[model samples]
Target chain A: MGELLPLMLQGAWVTLQITFWASLLAIACAVLGALGRLSPFAPLRWFSITYIEVFRGTSLLVQLFWLYFVLPMPPFHVELSAFSVAVLGLGLHIGAYGAEVMRGAIRSVAPGQYEASLALNMTPLTRFRRIILPQALLAAIPPGTNLLIELLKNTSLVSLITLSDLAFRARQLDQATFMTLEIFGLTLVLYFLMAQAINLAMRLVERRLGRGRIKGGLA
Target chain B: MSMQQRFDDSPMVRPSRRDGSAEPLVRFDQVTKRYGSLTVLDQLNLEVSPGEKVAIIGPSGSGKSTLLRALMTLETIDDGVIEVDGEPLTHMPTAGGHLIPANARHQRRIRGRIGMVFQSFNLFPHMNALQNVIEAPVQVLGMSKAEASQRGEELLAMVGLEDKLGHYPAQLSGGQQQRVAIARALAMRPKVMLFDEVTSALDPELCGEVLNVIRQLGEAHNLTMLMVTHQMGFAREFADRVCFFYKGRIHEQGTPEELFGNPREERTQAFLSAVNEAH
Candidate 1:
């Protein structure tokens, strides 16, 4: 039991590291994708749409496999470590979903904000940065938290690519000791706790952003 | 013909040189606007002199609000030119004397001279009254935070919102929000202020408060003011001139006394009588 505990803890550490790095990457991708989608340039809008649709349309497992195997074998000749591939696959997959959420949030901002900024003679960049983005960030966070937790769960798929995540450790321990119920049950609890932690952190951010903001008004 | 040259060229007309004389501050010359089949403004030719207070009154869809909006550049006109302080606003003049639709830079240059208050009171909901007032001055005009804040407080106080400095738009009453909107516009120090039915969305009791602030502005400020309004009595008292609009044209215009008391046009007479009966 003690030996199994140590292995599971190590696996959990790997899982946490993947989630942390992947979340950062996902946030960057989501922001860029959202802005690109909304951009005035036709090519940028189309590229964003393509990236989002392709990632969201395909299976995450297949994406991970492609990144891990296919990229190194063809004319592309791109090579990456298993951990890097895992991060890229999870980040890109969840980021596509986050992009849609962010796009919707950005569009949901009242047209009056744009008009008021225009009346103020603010530049387009200034209007988006100062007025639109902050408001959109507030709208995006709840759904973003959901996507983050989904990314965490999706990390389990990386075990197939040789990343020893918690799911991988749990399976190995269950097969070696025939302790499937206890090991798998604990893995589920750990994942649930990690997801809850993410939810709590996002809620705190939501409250901070919401400070002094007029919400759900006649506006 | 290059895009770079188009954007880089200086405006043919410089900043206004009006010294508050008989010079027209805002001129709409044969300006036409249409929304699909509906003609919003048809060859609308109107001139407002420096420091003049003009009120446009008309029934719904008579193009009164559109007139104010066109001045604010909120609604683009289909043809003709809008000049602010002798400078082209809707069109930029080339060296060859041809008018082209003004580029973004040109539009922005002219836009800075005008401020507008909407019927809905578009105060930024994310910001407090003071923040809303300070944002543009600090961001667009490059005023230091300290200078903008001081000016912002003064503007808010001028609008009688001294106590509500920290209140968000949602926290303030409709009249209070409109007053804050006025202060926000005033902070920009615009040469022209357009009020588009600013009091229409307010309660009857609340309407007086917003109008009072505007009345005070009319008396105190030297800005060229244009108002699109439904308040006949307030217009009679506050406006230097009243232009009655009908079917995308100024049907009649004169001093408020003459326009309201001895309306020359049959349409003006009918509109005034109908309004008087309603009140």
Candidate 2:
């Protein structure tokens, strides 16, 4: 039991790193995908739709296997390390769902805000930056937090690609010790704790965004 | 010929110089706007001098709001042109001196001289009163933060909201929100201001505060004002001329005393009596 602790902790650390890096990448992809989907240009919109549908409609595990297994073959000799593949696969998968969330939030901004920005003579870029984006973000955060938690959970899938994440480490420890219950139970608690941490951080962010306004108790 | 050539070739009715009056600050030259088959503004022609105050009053869907909206460039007019300070708004002059549909850049530059207040008092919800007032100056006009804040403070004080600068739109009452919106518009130092039912959304008690601020603005600034209002008493006192609109056209217009006291047209009389009865 005591030896199981150190190995599990090491696995948890790798899992945390993957979640943190993948989340950053996911946010960038979501913003780009959402804006591209809403863009006036037809080619960009089509590309965004295709990216979203292909990733979201397909299985995330298959997508991960393809990145890790298939890419190093002939014709498409793209080689990446296991860690890079893990982050890229999880980020792209969650980003497709986040894009739809962001698009809906942007569209939900009241027409009056656009009109007011127009009356103030703001350029399209300035209007989005100063007025539209801030309001849209407020509406996006709740749904975005959900997508992020799913991203955190999805990091467990990287164990199959030879990455020593929490799930992978627990299995390895259980095989060596033949004590499945103790190691697997601890792994479950660690994941729940990490998810709770995400919820706490998101609540703080919602509070910051909602400062100076009447508290609606949305969280 | 294209519609552009036909409009350009038509004889221009230049204002008479013999009268010694100044050129009109804003002109609508046979402007027509339609939403599908329904015409909202039917061949509308109106002029406003540099310092004039014109009140537009009409029943619902009579194009009273649409008139101000077209001038603000919120609604596109189907035919004819709108001009501000002797420059065409809906159309731009080419190198050959022919008029063509104005682009976004042209519209933005021309409409910079105008500001509009909506019926809903659409203040930015995320910003406090002071931020709302100074946002346009800092972002759009490229004014320095210090300079814009000073201007914003003065405008808020002028509108009797100095103490509430830190309050968000949700925290402020409807009247205070409207006043903040007014300050926001005035911070741009617009030459023309359009008030589209500015007090319509306020409670009856709250409307007095907003109307008082507007009255003070009229006395303090050299602004050309167009107000679409339901408040007949305020129009009577504040407007230089009152236009009674019916069915997308100005059916009658005159000084407040002439129009309100002795409306010549029967439709005007009927509308006034109906409004009077509602009160």
Candidate 3:
């Protein structure tokens, strides 16, 4: 039991790194995908729809396997490490879901806001950056928090690709020591703690974004 | 002056055209706008001088709001040309003296001289009152933040919201929000200001506060103003000219006394009587 602690903590560190890097990549993809979906140009709109449908419609595990197993063969001879494959696969998968969330939030802004921005002679870029994006982001945060927690849990899937994540370490320790209850229970607590951390961070962000409209709250 | 010569000179070099003497500041020449089969504005021809106050009154769906929306570039006119300050709004002039559809850049440049306030008081919900007022000045006009903040404070003070500078739109009353909206529009220093039923959304008591601010503005500034309103009593006192619109055209127009006191057209009389009964 004492020996299992250090290995599990090391595995947890790997899990944390994957979650951090993949989330950054996911955010980038989500913003690009959402804006592309709403773009006026036809080709960009089509591309966004295709990317979203393809990533979201297929199984996420198969996506991981394809990036890890299939890409290094024949016509598409691209090679990557197990960590890169895990981050790319998880980021792309979660990004498709985040894109829809962002698009709905962007559309939910009142038409009058756009008209007010136009009346002020705001350039399209300034209007989005200043007026539209801030309002849309406020609407996006609650749902976005859910997607992020899912991404953190999904990091367990990286174990299958030979990465030594928390889940991988638990299985190895379980086989070696045959103490399933002790190791797995501790693993659950660690995962829960990390998820709660994400929840707290997102709530703080939502409060900051909504500070202007909320009365009697900290400015 | 020949049309070509007028086009050749810079827009700033043009003479100040005011009140039945020089050229009109705003002209809608046979302007037509249609939303599908419904003709919202039917070949509307109107002229406004540089410092005139025109009140547009009509029943719902009479195209009064549509007329203001067209001038503000919120709605595209289906045909004819709308000109502001001796330049085309819906079209751009080429060096060869041809008029083509105005692009986004051209429209922005032309519409920069105009401002509008909506009945809904569409202030940005996430920004405080002073932020809303100074947003365009800092972003669009490239004014420094300090200078824009100074102007924003003064404008908010003018609208009687000096104490509520940090309040967001959700924190303010309907009338207070509309005043902030007015201050936001005025911060741009537009030559023409369009008010589209600005007081209709407020309660009767609140309407007095907003109307008083507008009356002060009219007395203090030489701005050319156009208001589409349902308030006949306010129009009678505030407007230089009152236009009665019916079925996408100005049915009759005259001084407020001539039009409201003795409406010549039967439609105008019926509309006024109907409006008077509502109050």
Candidate 4:
């Protein structure tokens, strides 16, 4: 049982690494998608909204399976590892969710901000870079931080496809050693620790961004 | 930073005007503005020379604000052209001297010379007083931060807002915010400045300070000013000329003495009497 603890810990580390890489991909996709949807041009808006709706409408499991099985085996072919497939699939799915959250945050920026930027004769690009992005990021952090935590938990579901995350190791250790209680209990503790740490860090970030607006911030 | 271009040739807003060439600094030629079916401005014609301070007064919905907004290009003209310094506002000519109307980029280039201070003082809430003043000069006018900061300091000093530069808009009182807004507008070094009821949103006691700042700016800066105000006494004191609008058109316009003391139009007479009757 104790031996299984070290293996589970190793798997937990790998799981966290995947979550971090996937979140980086997801946030990049989020910034691009939100900008597309919010663009003044109709074509970009239509393309972004369509991409989000289609991805969000499908099941995440189906997306993972497709990314793993279908995308690599086409007559015009490319190949990737199971871990990469899982991360890309999860990121793609949540990137859609993150885009919507970003859109909502951007919409909440007061109309005066837009008018004020226009009054200054600001170019559209400069306006977004300076005024719109700063305010939108401040508004986006609270809900977005929670979404990232949910993304970490959902990474466990990828262990079903043999990416060897914590949940996969837990099942294997329970089967080999018949010490299900201690091994599975340790896995649960690891997830709790990881998720709580992420939550706490994000709360700190939210406080800094939302300063002066909220009283007793982070509480 | 360099005042060379605007001041080099006799410093006239219209070179022809002060030079006796008679070019109008701003002209609204038979302009009409409509929102859906409601005509806010109808076939309005007006002219102001370089450095003229014109105050427009009427009850709400008389389209005075809309008129100023149209000049700033914040609101598009439905029917006519706005000319600034002998140039048509929405377009310019190529080197060949062929007249081509402007695209968004060109419009932005020309609109650079116009500044507006809103009644609500729409300072960016996330920005502190200093950033709000410096943003346009740094971004739109392409000044470096150090240069922008120096210019911003001068403007804040002009508005008596040097002490409040570190505070955010939400922290400042209404009058202070409006003064900061005036500084922001001035930082652009715009030839034309538009004020849409600048004092209407301030407290009665605070209104005097902001108005005084504006009066000084009007006198000191060679700016073409278009203002919409309801403060009769301030209008009488500050305006080089007064335009009394009724419904959607100017009922009468003249110097303050001619407009206030010897208004020839019946509508102007009634408006002046009602306003002065307010104790």
Candidate 5:
């Protein structure tokens, strides 16, 4: 039990870092992807669609391996750090999916809002910033919170990249002490706790945004 | 003959230059707008002096709302020009008199002067009633936060929503929401205000409150309000002038008494009678 505490605590630190960086990347990707899909240009729309489909179509493990091995090989003299590449792969793989989520959220803003803005002669940028984005982003949070929790689980794959994340540390402790079940079981508990916290945070946000009573119905 | 104007034949539209007043506040000159072959406003011309509240009543698809939308620069007319407060919209060309490439900046400048309320009360769902009213003044007018809040509070009070400042659109009743929408438009302190069937979506039970607010606006404010509504009673009671639109043309227009009580056009009489019967 004495040895178990340090191993788990150390492993948890790596897990925290991984989750932090991954969430940041996911949000950045979601914004870019959302904008790309919303772009008037056909190419941008097609490219965004393609990126989302390809990433969501394949397995995340395969993509991670491809980034770590295949990308670094073949006449490339640079030896980029595995940790950086792993986060990039994870962010890219998850961001494509995140972007689609964003697109749907943005599009859900009613036509009435657009007409209202037009009447005021609001510039499109101001219209989005003041009127559209805040509402869409608020509406998007409940669904996006679930996807983000899913992202935390997939980030376990980053352990294979030689980073000392929770999963990686678990594997090390299992081999050294010949106690695989306990180590792996503890890893699962940590992930479960982390995911639960995320869910809780999301619920709080949902409640805050949902407090408003919509002024609807025709006179 | 080449254009359709609300005031093409009307004595009111011919605000004479001899008076030495400011140039016409709004003008739609020989403007032809088409939605991919469906001609909405064909060579439409209309004008409003600095202080005129023109209530436009029309049959469906008669382009009443489109006229107001075009002035707000929400919908662009394909040909000819629209001017707001004497500034040529669609931009001035290199040689002048020709239309340049339409840019959002130009649209914003023109639109800033025009406030519009839509058929649907399009309040920002995320923002509370107070924030919605405070948006333009703080964001577009660049009023200091204190000034914007002060003006916003006064506007909300005017709409009878001072108690409901913290309430979101989803939280308010329809009439209350529409009142907030009106207050939101007025928060801009615009040169012109457009109401496009604002009460069309309301229940009859709930409409009177909003109508009463509008009547107050017309009676008290020194405003140039262009409203497209089917509320003929309100049109007659509140409007200084009323214009009847049909097949993309103003078929008849005059003082409310002349247009509604003693409608000169046979078609208008039939339409108003039918509307009166339906009610």
Candidate 6:
């Protein structure tokens, strides 16, 4: 148990790194995808819909496998590290879902807001940045927190892609010590603690944003 | 009968005879608007001179609101030109003698000179009353924060919301929120103001306060104002010219004495009677 603890901590570190990177990538994709969907240009809207559908329709495991295994072959030959592939796979998968959440939030903002901004003669960019986006961000936070927690859970899948995440370490330690029950139990607790941390961080953000408006609860 | 005689005998609001050569502040030159198969406003021709207060009263679906919305550029028209301050707002003229739909940049540039207050009091819920008034000035007009805040305080005070500057729209009463909306619109110093039933959403008791503010603005300010209102008394008292719209056209328009005191059209008489019954 003493020797395995150190190895498990190292694996946890990798899990944290992957979650952090993947979360950032997911947010970027979500924002771009949402903007594209709302854009007036037909080609941009089409490209965005295609990207969201292709990522969301397929299986995450297959996507990770393709990124890690298939791309290295002759025709594509676009090799990536296991860590990068894990980030790309998880980020793109969750991002497709998050895009709809983002679009819905933006649309949920009252039509009166757009008209008021127009009456004030605000430029489109100024209206989005100053009026529309801030209100939409508050609306998006609840669903966004859910997506982020899901992203954290999905990091466990990176182990199958040869990434030494916490799940990977748990399996390795169980086989070595033959204390499968104790190792797996500890792993479950570890994942719970990580999720709790995310909840705490997101709650603080929600509180800060919920100051001016009335709707969202503190929890 | 004697009260009616007295109202008719009182001096009417004289129409402004501004510089004879100056263009009207707003002109809807044969404007036609549509929504799919429905024609919202059909070949609507109207004019508003600077410092003139025009009240539009009509039954529901008579295209009264659309007329103001068209001037605000909130709705697009299918044909005809909407000119503000003698310049086209809905279209821009090309060098080859053609009129094309104005782009967003051009629309915004023209729309800046007009301010609109909605029936719902469309104040930004996220911002306090003061911030709502200052937002346009600081962002669109590029006024310094200090300057905008100073002007914002003055506008809020004008609307009798001096103490509620820090309150969000939700915290204020409907009447107070509408007043804030007025302040927010006025902050832009628009050459023309459009009020689309600004007091319709307020309680009956609350309506007086908003109307009072508008009355004061009408008496003191030189801005051109167009109000689509259901308040018959306020319309009679405040407007220089009262237009009774029916079926997408001004069925009858004249001085308040001429229209409200003695409407010539049968539709106008029916509409006014129905409104008076509700009142």
Give each candidate's fraction of reference contacts reproduced: 0.65, 0.53, 0.63, 0.38, 0.67, 0.57
Worst 10 residues of 1 chain A by lDDT: A210-219
TM-score of chain A of 2: 0.95
Backbone collision tally, model 2: 0
Native-vs-model 6 lDDT?
0.88
| TM-score of candidate 6 relative to the true fold | 0.91
Compose the digit string of candidate 5's lDDT tens values, residues A69-177.
7777877644667777667777887788888888898898887888887766566788887778776777688778878888887877887777787778888888888
- The collision pairs in model 6 are none
lDDT of 5 by residue, B1-279 (tens): 211253365433445488775457888888877898798887877888767888999899989988887877777778888887666777654555466865777767767788888778888877788888888788777888888888888888887889999988877888999999999999887879899998998888889989888888877877889999999888888887899988777888999989888998998999999999998
Give lDDT tens digits, candidate 1, residues A1-219.
667788888898899899989998898889889999999999999999999999999999999999999999978899999999988999999999989999999999888888889999999989998999888989999899989999999999999999999999999899999988889888988899889988998899888877676566655
Alpha carbon lDDT at B57, candidate 3: 96
Whichever of 3 and 4 has more TM-score, that candidate is 3
Kindly report which residue stretches of model 6 are placed more than 4 angstroms away from their true locations once superposed. A1-4, A216-219, B1-22
Chain A: TM-score in each model: 0.94, 0.95, 0.94, 0.91, 0.87, 0.94
How does residue B91 of candidate 2 score in lDDT? 90
Collision count for each candidate, in order? 0, 0, 0, 0, 12, 0
Where does model 5 exceed 4 Å of error?
A42-47, A70-79, A211-219, B1-22, B93-97
lDDT of 4 by residue, A62-143 (tens): 8887777777786837677888987888787888899988888889887767776887899888988888877788788878
lDDT of 4 by residue, B1-279 (tens): 333454455433433445553456788888889999999899998988778899999878989999988887778877777777667776667888665776898788778878899888888766778888999899888899999988888889889988877887777888998999999988888888989998888889999989999899888877889899999888889999999998779989999999998999988888889888985
Candidate 4: CAPRI quality band:
acceptable
Query: If both were scored by lDDT, which would come out higher, candidate 2 or candidate 5?
Result: 2
Compose the digit string of candidate 2's lDDT tens values, residues A125-181: 999888888778778888999998999899989999989999999999888998999
Residue pairs with colliding backbones in model 1 are none
Task: Summarize candidate 6's per-residue lDDT along A1-219 as a digit string, tens digits.
Answer: 778788888988898888889988998888789989999999999999999999999989899999999999989999999999999999999999889998998999889899989889998898998888878877888899899889999999899999999999999998889999889988888888888888888788777765556664111
Q: Which candidate's lDDT is highest? A: 3
